[model samples]
Target: MRENEPHRTGPVLIVIGGLPATGKSTVGRAVARRLGGSCLGIGTTRQSLYAFAEHGGDTDTLRHAVTHGLGYSVAYALVEDLLSQGQCVFAECVNSRKATRDAWAALARRTEARFHEVELLCPDPTEHDYWRTAGRALAEP
Candidate 1:
């Protein structure tokens, strides 16, 4: 039989939050890769909103609201689903506000999974601005 297979258990939930150009997605993906887990990007959720707006669903403002509202719900659902199935998940998002962070924490509580918050910071102002602008340019496609 396999070695130590019976002791394996559920996966951990890692929630990453940061500002624009803060490398939340980059580092979250790295952590998830190392841990053999999955990474979910909030931007992917927003892109779906943009697509809906492009298809004449709503205005930009409405799209933003709907994306923000639905994105968290979707993210939470992903984490819950992964946990239920004995898998781990890593979520990357700006999570600029305390309320958003708190909501994730609450989800962790309900799922009985450990939650970790990691913030990315750039010590050099110039470097931070450079990365921010460069990231924006690359994101523009």
Candidate 2:
């Protein structure tokens, strides 16, 4: 949001969750772009943590924290910062556990931001399998 712009609801926290290959990133990024906000992915955060660790900058043991719940923690902090600035955020992740989803909602409440959780599911197994395969192929060098 620009300094001169006005937002009706302050900021919004959009959490997109689903199993792998459910199109969370695609949807999240598209929505973020449309909303003129930021898009964040859990895998991207984890890779960042890994890269920093590889570069020998674990000031707070971030590498070890990544193995735990640091990615979500970092995401929370990032989202909170953006919300404080009146910018919406779209966060896509495999919230495979209920605890993770709950934590995201809790963060939204703590920040007094509107929270939306969208869980994508591919009911067609064939298409889902193709997405999974394509995702793996894309990951391969």
Candidate 3:
């Protein structure tokens, strides 16, 4: 059996959150990969909203409401499905707002999963600026 499969003694959810360019995606992806699990990114889902909207989807008002709600909605569904299958999940999001973070925590509680929250920060302004400007990190620190 795989390491993750054996460790599936219980559900596990790793939630990574931070400001843009703070490497939340990188960390979440890495952790999930290391554990042979899944990485579900809110930003990816959020970006897809634009593509859907471009395809004659909805009005701006509806798009805005959907964008705000879709990430959490999809993430919660993924978490539930994966956990039910005894799979680990790492969720990456810009959970700067307390409500959003609390929602993730609540989902973990509802699923009876072990919830781990990781808030990333870049201490070096130079590095942070570089990542923000280039839209990528030079390396994971």
TM-score per model over all chains: 0.84, 0.84, 0.84
Question: Can you write out model 3's per-residue Cα lDDT over 57-88, one digit (the tens) per residue?
Answer: 45586578666787678778877888767678
Taking the candidates one at a time, how many backbone clashes does each contain?
A: 0, 0, 0
Which candidate leads the pack in lDDT?
2
- Model 2 alpha-carbon miss at residue 65, Å: 3.0
What residue pairs clash in candidate 2, if any at all? Answer: none
lDDT of 1: 0.77
Model 2 C-alpha RMSD vs. true structure (Å) is: 3.9
Q: Kindly list the per-residue Cα lDDT of model 2 for residues 70-132, writing each as its tens digit.
A: 888888888888888877889899988989989988888888889999999999999999989
Would you list the rank order by lDDT, best first? Answer: 2, 3, 1
CA RMSD of all predictions: 3.0, 3.9, 4.1
Where model 2 places Cα greater than 4 Å from the true spot, the runs are 1-7, 56-64
